[model samples]
Target: MPSRLRARDRVQGPCLGAPAYGSAVTTPRLVVEEELLRRNIDRVAVGARVAGVALRPHVKTHKCLEIARLQVAAGATGVTVATVGEAEVFVHAGFDDVLVAYPLWLDDDRATRLARLAGRARNAIGVDCTESAARARAMLPDVELMVEIDSGHHRTGCAPGDVGEVAAAGGVRGAFTFPGHSYSPDGGSGAAADEARALAEAGKALVAAGVEAPVLSGGSTPSLAHTDTGVVTELRPGVYVLGDAQQWELGSCSPDDIALTCHATVVSLAGGRVVVDAGSKVLGADRAAYSTGFGRLLDHPDARIVMLSEHHAVIEMAERPPLGTTLRLVPNHVCNAVNLADELWVGDQRWSVAARGRNG
Candidate 1:
């Protein structure tokens, strides 16, 4: 790399949200609305408080230390992370309580890394099967663990009724599950109900196995509003902080609730199509079967992103603008979009995506 090819050189002018700033800000930049983000955080936090449930929000959405600190200040007990690397990053940044929500099958190296991370904070990883439990124990013998149960998601977790042995094994703490199926239209309530039932069953299993399952965590933004109170002791929703197009379409969140978007430049106005520089790489190619497109054009809500390549988004807009038009596009999946960027812009300020690329 040349000396002139620095990070600063790659950046453009001032941010859009900044008052009295220039209009030539960078394209394909991850832009976060400060006020909207605060509103979103407070919404979930207040709801959890009213429901008498602990808010251990998942931090994989933003992957920014500043955002996690805000969540903690808003009354999050801890944070749920996807991998050991994320836990380490948060723990290093003064977040002592971290839970790796995904099921971990640890080897020697991974185990050692997790153990060290555990030592620096109150760490726990999710375990689905006996094999994962055994491996987790062998790797981080002193760390607490959570038994992941299949709560209608049919994901990595095991059956709630059959997790008795896994929960009773050494280093096990409680049970948790994700309401992943809630993304479907009008499926939030039912998926949340499934989460509650699964947690109850897993709790009973743990009791029968002579283990005290203290923490019962369940969450997903779509199902968060409908998640039953008593069964789940803690909620761990990630996408709520940065509302996406999917959440908007599912009636989980309104347009005003969306706080994050990709700032893109209109590079072409060919026929009825409006092409933008932001595409799958920056906005993410997460067009769910129920979703409208890759991302939603905030400037033109009705415009559909008909096509998305690595570097271009072809939006269908009847009224085409000039070549140098700027627009904000809301991602279909905010988590994936944020993970793709190195930093996020909040008005004129910038926040580093500290946990970015911690996929392992």
Candidate 2:
């Protein structure tokens, strides 16, 4: 094991003091605490190692090359991305293993891009149907394909038992699924179980179809803790790297585990209400049904972000702070909030969101 990457049983140091929040700092900026960020990264990496499974963390959370490099250095097998553009960015940065986790509809341009990427790295694409699988196999034969099992997400994948034809289509390497329903208030455990069962069934179906399924992948930040590592050979969790309001509220992580925050200033004190400059444009408008509010104050946990405008957040609390007071706002969904920013601050250094806006 590397010296920098600590095991889960390792004793942690005392929590560092808060970042310097003074006149020189700017509001509506995304900031990450370096120590806490590394802590979160190592936690998952070590967890996967302890369970004897591969850790190919989804990079759609931070999208920064620096963070992805950290994961690689900490013993990650590879990195999981959402699009071909993201895969290109990481591959250019010298990441050899990349997985485009989306069931892509490969056009000519995308096929060309993926072929180029596969030439440089050991790459794979997701396929939920035989049509896409055959198209991907024909267009980019060098790239491996992973059948996407629905696994209860019901968003973009096929049913588990139906993965046989997709796997048999061509160039099938294994199977994968996303337990996204784990984001619900009490869906973590159940979703993890469903993910295990689905992946297991998919593996059996692949074998029945005469396809050898070696890589069984399934994981989400909320349900990762409850996942059956015995069934999932590879875990692809993204949000565990950056704690958000939803994770905190769902008891997935403690309040102190949060490593990222939107630094905002109290800009208003009208009618006994407090308003901050961070709003939908910065913090992102992603309030889930189970979310308590738009977001919450990291320091002032009692305060709630009741409303949000394009440029401001209306906060409700008992004691209002002074007009110039600064606060750390934990966004409801860190992934979207990060996409809205061009860069993230870690201490005084800035890291570009290199893969931002690679939506295609």
Candidate 3:
């Protein structure tokens, strides 16, 4: 432990111990505790098994092959991604099965890329409309296709009834949806129900169209726990493996379930505030409408990141630590925060963010 910093909880270790995090890997570095991370993986894996739902967890959360390997070993049938680029990374890394869950706008170049990826691994692309579905088949003829349904997120995916039209366009394997609206005020269970209903109806619609809707997938972290198995066959909850402040606020995970935290150092202090050298550039500027702040101090749960510049986070703290003290902060959105960093520290060893910039 650092001679200067006193002992506290597990989160306070890097600060209290010598070879302090700041000295090893500058400030504002994303870190993953292996034990906690494995626990999270196990938590979700057990849940999926008990619920009798297939687990094909989204890998955009960690973006690390090491973490994805852990998830696969734990029981994830396959890994899910948001972009074609992400699928390429994992496929090259030997992930046999992958699903680009987002409805991608495939330009000619992206089509050729998906074609090559399909040859290397069992990859599937998403299409929410007939135009995209036709584009997917004509361009990347080798890959499987999943028609996206708008359970409640309304971000992408078509209406459940429209699934038949998209499937009729041909080459569709099944249906998928994201209940992102589950992030709202106490909306997990209800959104889960909504997702099941939408996907079930969508599946029947696809079958009615004679498109063989075998794979029915849907899930997000918050709504994952309440996700029932009937309409949704495969579940993909990314953030459950590395939770964030938003997940904590949604009661999706406890403080202990959070495995990813940023190691930031207190640079200065003012009346009623402590400034840390980690900000939106590293912590991400993803404070959801319902969130309390941009980030949360791990050691000081009550402290809120009141302000965030590109390189500084202004925290409101009751008892501030001295200057140069390292404090671990759990970001509001772990997925975005991880994307901001180059590598992650698992205690002393460094792990590369293999798919950091693989956002297509």
Candidate 4:
């Protein structure tokens, strides 16, 4: 039925012949492949380079110091963090440039720590209100501040038109927006355009009020590809480095690009379902309406993850896999799933989660 193939085709599958009965066999554990990570990193870097924009990748997705170092080494100008503790960890790890992207309500201890940290690194803080600005100014007056504009995320940014007032109150040095609402499947180009317009207007407003808004930053992995460079000077995309089900659904990445996965072994099989060792505790419960299941089965893409528990993940397999077989599970949200593990096994090497429980 088919034509004769070359010698390369005959020497397919395993390069070597099948193993002997007595040969040693070892299973992979918690794998984070270096090749996958490099591919994803290069994809984002190329996209930003083509658009002539600076990429300050968000490190909140993967809180590993080794991964952060890899991101920086891969041409990332700096890193964006979500918490003071995160920033402190990276600073102590020797990352000189950091942006605390969250609008923090600084208390006495936090203010003192932030001030000290700002003095050490090229640091900047986010401000959404006058109270935050006053607190930051009182705590770290010399530290650069960015007015957080609400570019349709409606999370923690001020109104775009209120940029001047917010900047004036906090003595802000720049302006930035998250543009997180652009994650929706239908909200790609339109949302990015709106975010660009909002950031540009906010930057103009801040400059008009005598505040020097030099850093106009706005981006997320979903909007990173669609963003216009004319308005935003810097882009901060976190999940692009290690794609998740959300990124896959948004068409931001392919299945092969997913670098992180839960290496779980099937422990039981009953009721026409196979139960794995990993559950909500390891994989997390971050199902979206568009998502087909809780997580994806790496070996068997057709298998559906029907349910998840504290230490078990139930899969509705078409043809049940062996009970002892190990399956790789890619999470719906890589950030939360990563937070669950104390360490990650990259190939044969193990790396510690330096910032694992640093969610303050």
Q: If scored against the real structure, what TM-score would every candidate get?
A: 0.93, 0.93, 0.93, 0.90
State the lDDT of candidate 3 residue by residue for 23-75, as single tens digits: 44457788888999999999889988888888999999989999999999999
Query: lDDT tens digits, residues 183-272, model 2?
Result: 898889999999999999988988888776468999999999999988999999998898999999998988889999988877888767
List, residue by residue over 1-360, the lDDT tens digit for candidate 1: 655555545344332332333545658799888999999999899999988999999999999999999999999999999997888899999999999999988877778787677667888889899888887777667878898998998878999997887865676778899989998999999999999999999888888877764688899999998888889999999999999999999999998888998888778776657898988999888989998877787657787888999999998876676666667788899999999999999988999999999977
Q: Which stretches of candidate 4 lie over 4 Å from their true place?
A: 1-29
- Kindly indicate the candidate among 2 and 3 with the higher lDDT: 2
Candidate 2 achieves a global lDDT of 0.88
Clashes of each: 0, 0, 3, 0
Which pairs of residues clash in candidate 2, taking residues 3 or more apart in a chain or in different chains? none
For candidate 3, the lDDT comes to: 0.86
Candidate number achieving the greatest lDDT relative to the actual structure? 2
Clashing pairs in 4: none
lDDT of model 4 at position 246? 77
